[model samples]
Target: MDPLLLLFSLSAATCAYLLWFYLLARNLTGPKVWPVFGSLPYLFLNRKRMHDWIASNLCSTGGAATYQTCTIALPFLARRQGFYTVTCHPKNIEHVLRTRFDNYPKGPTWQTAFHDLLGQGIFNSDGDTWLIQRKTAALEFTTRTLRQAMARWVNRTIRTRLWVILDKAARDHTPVDLQDLLLRLTFDNICGLTFGKDPETLSPEMPENPFAIAFDTATEATLQRLIYPGFLWRLKKVLMIGSEDRLKKSLQIVENYMNEAIDARKEKPSDDLLSRFLKKRDMDGNLFPISVLQRIALNFVLAGRDTSSVALSWFFWLVMNHARVEEKILRELKTVLTESRGGEPKRWMEEPLTFDEAEKLTYLKAALAETLRLYPSVPEDFKYVITDDVLPDGTFVPAGSTVTYSIYSVGRMKAIWGEDCMEFRPERWLTAGGDRFEPPKDGYKFVAFNAGPRTCLGKDLAYLQMKSVASAVLLRYRLSTVPGHRVEQKMSLTLFMKNGLRVYLHPRTLA
Candidate 1:
């Protein structure tokens, strides 16, 4: 055949396949599919509120639904072809994430995207490797020495450094973007704990930091991979494309910085987390290699940095929108402080607040939980089927299908959370006895921190960070939203404000 004829024939076949897929999908009574694009076009149409769009589509087409006979752009890659996506239905989630869990793994596609950034760390590994990493991480996280170090580090950073900057802004009657401030604060604190050096991006001056920029670029690239077609990704890699080049540059910057920090820490040992890991050995009596240490550091930086900051940012935004909630939080803070300081206003900067003191603020903890219920940092997560399985609801999912659980949508589901599910009501978290409501045993019903064996390991640490920061700031300064600021959620791995949260703070005076 002539070259022109061959090219025309290939295009004709692709169009025929797409047309057949559309007709076949339309006949099935589930989520609708568009020719050539499948549900991707619908996702792009409502990219801003993709989570809500997916949930609404799922609810409209029965609670547990799938889009059959869809076409992904990349048909050559067997693993990336014709994926089946699922949303949050309790039984469905339980089947995939908990019951018959061994039949589902994070899958090769997911690992490929994150492996470059996280290496072989816990977040990217499975089987014996995952078990080993999780066990080691759990042990280190719960140690008395590490716990004490983390407490001291958080107190100094939040109480001493961050509040000082916020105090100055308040005194000057300046509006601060709490989102940016929280990111810097968490980044610096994570760095100090992990590497024993402070990036100091949280300072009032706010110097331009290269590591922060590179880290942001890496995260953006990872998100892009989620939406882009697999063939395009591979082609870009082969063609020396700019997107791949930029990703490499960003990763190089992070790697170089981590290597230098590891070298410095090795030369002069410190009591930081990295040093502690370096000093300890596995059951084989062999210390973790530098490469493994680097991988661990990368995982810590990526996992610990954005999620907490984003969560706290949303928490403050929710409080600002609901004044009644803010007043209740303030009242709780005052009561906790009074109890802690023996009827006196606790002095800041001069004395560090103990972890026990921070933990005693029951209302503060409840407020944090409510914030998580509204805006889970990780809005959704993906898994792939390893074996053909039937859900408890009798929805048959074939092997190699992709499954997604929408944490954000689950938070807003009326069937799960009652009629005021969409409202920002912290009282929902309060018991009739006026104490904080304990989370349910089967957490799939309210899976902000996720449930089962894969639940977040840093849940306790995150709460501690939020309570400490919120307590210190709310006690000393009153924050109100800037007028005309449209704060809406952004859809990334974590939920952040589309427009950065702008709030004006005024120093509170004791009467």
Candidate 2:
């Protein structure tokens, strides 16, 4: 047999196989897929701007109503069996989140990835574990005492620490990292509300808090487990190297702080969430174990700290860009001040808004809502499919596949929010009279807090905290972004500003 003839035969067979694979993947609406490598190359290339990349792919297929769902096929990576069905379609999101709620839990991959950081906490657990915690938390959140406790923490932080720092910055004419400041402010606030202990990350010196640093390290390392292949992270864990190694040290610091706080709470219970959780019994009529309590405290911090701060950061940046919206918010604040405090701008600027006063900030609330629509803290969320299911848009997702609903993409969809969806118009959220705030009736359309049974229990609390901080800052100071400073999004579990919101503060004066 001639060697050239044999080589020609093999080459022909390879071409035939490649042609078949291309034909099969041609109809799929997602990033370009390659043989063997699948979409890995494309994903790696666009990793920095993943959310926008996904939105572009979905939009290119067709707008929301036509082709709102797309598939990403990965040949390796055992999680979700290497198949992901990403969708921003409201109907499909509703079906996955509400109608077939039981069919989708946080699932094993998510639980496993976050177990060291979150344990069997409500956010990480499924079934009975999550249900019991949710029921208990729901009850506690509804209590006026808890809300009052949160208010006290928030007001004290603003009046004592945040205002002083911002005032100093204004006086010195120095640019400050508002995002970093907000992160510290919220961290202190959340720690106080969660465990009755404040790390005081927002102090005058703006010193580093070991506990806060450890928690951030741990959270970031844990997220790496989700991004890298399951086996890769697991092997790193076994070897005690890389991000897994950092996770171990960070977890130790986090646990120590939590244990100390838990011991203190046990000795003398306070009005914080930790004290309330300590008083409650678990599934087996037992007090939650030390381990469980630690995770619960960490979970609340993880939820309360990042989301509110990130949302506030984006809100400030948006307001800084849109002066018309800022003027409207100021006018509304002035109206509220006039009605309640004899219209003294100077006196009002001296103090933070009380919880009751923050409630009167309806337009400001709408602006915050508008900000969240465009920049959700958690831009994308993935749910694992339990049984084989058919989505509302006639797409079939297998039992082991993962479905990621893009909250960021939803805000950009023309079909869902009309042609002006991309515009930063708070008026869309207001009533015709412009006096009252109103959100879309469809829960799925605005899922920054998510929808259905798994909706955020801290929804009202988040609003309260944001309103308090937002009103406090805006009333006292006018924020201007630093010239030539770029604002870019960080690709993470949360939507953080990559460069931080660098701004100079100008003290507002009565005209």
Candidate 3:
């Protein structure tokens, strides 16, 4: 009799607890929540289309402002019910990025996830560490010499390796993976600018550089840490198994390469970022330690390689799909070239577009911006809340909670951009005259380069590299997507094409 009564009491308590959980979960505006799993099941199910899923959730929450700021339940993975506030609203974005900038840092989870690969680098650190690196990097990015160095590297790669490979592919009528090509090209270019050493990953032979492979492997492994819970990855790391094991090996290769580069720079200084950092003194008038320099150099490489290459990959795919946009870009390029070189298309096409010429292609830049609007390289970013605060849309985020701003979702929100927000139209970025490029009035709306004080310092250099590459490729060759080749998005930290962009290149004739 006593045992039966105890069983009944326990069942009643469990039912009561479930009811309480349901009541609180039903009040949340985001994805569905189970008892123990919270929204983990939904997140897992929609993993491939995670960004679009978040955008759908935000859109369904009563127009834009009514529920633009939504929270996901991950009670098990995070502390205090594991609520993650995801926002796509411009006002909320402004609030989190600028208005409450100090209140949001990289947070422990972010820093810890990336610490192994990135160390205490600028991108992975917060407060004074990030500030010092930012101030130092800002000073360097502003120098005319850095831009010139970047241009030299980009142009040389295009003129020698990239063009050579593409020309051979065109002659052979072979389909090439354009995404891989761009990744290699940007890898080589960034490596040169970062350490004055070129991995030459974009050679005609298409060799794989150990450092590049290791860097990519480490990045992917690091992203896995963010996707899964911290404890699970930590256990794997301790056990020396799975992705963590691969990460360990990759880090070794990367460290070796970086150490070699650092040693080389010390022996004979160059104008690369590493050399500059070596010469510059910190606050105490002391040289940055070897570990700090290595991390800083790795951070630059990480930032420079994937973003522009991924953006260019999407830009090419978009232009291939939208012939009208491609034609407009070509027309703009031709006009600029005609003005610059008296219409010697063939002669100029032999070499990549110069920095001056690339800057003149306003329409092309607009197209690249439009591409980023549709497909940002870093689709979403996470920030840790330092204090309890309310977003512009009135959504409250408590301390220790995570806030994610979806760049992908922001570009698709009709309330922010117009009904035609989903469409790829560079004209939106131009004035009525269509001669000059004009960004949106509210800088927060187009945050492909991010907004506020932490905005990308490499914005100008990124544009220079993208414009040079895009103009050179479009002017020299007409790309056609291979039949039966599928283009799908890869669910990773960077927006990469899962199947890669496969296309055949045909020589362009200028009549």
Candidate 4:
């Protein structure tokens, strides 16, 4: 009896809601952020191109912008929102990371998302927990003992596992995913250094390791959580579906591996990183529980594994692209090796590269640093604002707001790096004398390993490891990418080359 009247009423309600949403959405300045979804409409449309999209927006607003992702509820009744004050400004990076350091921490959002994987580990925890872990790590990382162990591990792994694999690939003329080889190398090296166990992940056969596979799965899934809202992800988590399911099983695999490693360490009690960690107790003088030990293990594994492998993969890719860079690196390598070995080229290849010898590869270190500048493994990270704060760039961040600084975007910013920022040039890092490599004086400017008190503890070790591998590989073989193999970045906690770095290897003759 009233069908026509009901239809008119429904139409009028729709018009009212549209008018209300339209009024609220117009206040957004940078992009046409839609109501409820905020910047997500544009973000969703450009998900594949996020790094560039974000850089484009940051460039539009003088290198800073207030991006919002609101709940899709009724306009006035919006439940919660994700207000990301994203900045690519270096001054703002210093302000948040150093000058006003106390104002920011990993925060609840990051901790919550990474909790399952990282737990109260160094990367996830804030406050006292973070301090304790940092101190403990500082102790382990700075030790000459650990550095010696790391050098042995790297040299042995490269000479034994990596060399044999590449030799086979070169002999067979087989195309290999260099990224996979590097990942295996790092995984084997880290597992031996950290767990007092060797997974032998870099063997010539290149078989799959479940722990490595699961680690990759869990990290990528968790990275996805950063983009999803709490409600949507929390509901998926509750239902045991989708990414949550993958995360659940992956963590299970990772935790089991950790526990198994711990048991082996306890039974044997060798002097690896795990043994050192095992001996340390909490502030209460009680030995850490298995859970704590697992986090420690996972934390170190995560740090030691991805960062070096990803860095090397990118470094090799960059070096291959620039013949001049490769030639310069080779010349430096020959000079350093010949000089170090008393002009004995054959002995340089035959003998193991020690810490003292690797330390002399200044140009190699410079090349790696330059690669990190353009493509940092951990490209993006964020902090939570504790109180109302004014960034150095004059952006106002309110309490309970989130601020994410993209190291990826920072490296590409012309304002900080000059007009040639886009160009891959290792010479930029070299000093005026053009002989020694000098990093940016400001922490925030070269933020690949982070900055200030939270600087990466493994920085020195990373350099030592990368230089050793690069030297060993270059002395034996010339690596070129497999033709028609696409290289792209995988969306993950680490800046992994999505398609993997596939390469063809040609053996270099010492004669």
TM-score of each: 0.91, 0.94, 0.96, 0.93
What lDDT is obtained when candidate 2 is compared to the true structure? 0.86
- Highest TM-score: which candidate? 3
Stretches > 4 Å off in candidate 4: 1-29, 62-80
Reference-based lDDT, residue 316, model 1: 84
Q: Pick the candidate with the highest lDDT.
A: 3
- Model 1 lDDT per residue over 1-511, tens place: 9999999999999888776664556554445566556667766677788777766766565444433334353344222455665666776787777887787788877788777777777777777667766777787787777767778778888766788788788878888889999999889988988889888898868887888998888777777666655666767767857667677889899889899889989998887778877886655778888887888887888778888899899888877678887787777766766776655564532455578777776777777887887788888888878877777766666677677777777767776676887788776666767776566555677777777777777778878878888877776777889899888878676787888889999877642
- Full-model lDDT for every candidate: 0.75, 0.86, 0.87, 0.82
Q: What stretches of model 3 exceed 4 Å from their correct place?
A: 1-9, 65-81
Error of 2 at 306 (Å): 0.4
The alpha-carbon lDDT assigned to residue 297 of candidate 2 equals 91
lDDT of 4 by residue, 22-45 (tens): 765554345665655766677678
Score residue 487 of candidate 3 by CA lDDT. Answer: 91
Candidate 2 residue pairs in backbone clash: none
Q: Using lDDT as the measure, what is the rank order of every candidate, best first?
A: 3, 2, 4, 1
Q: For each candidate in turn, give its C-alpha RMSD to the true structure in angstroms.
A: 3.2, 2.8, 2.1, 2.8
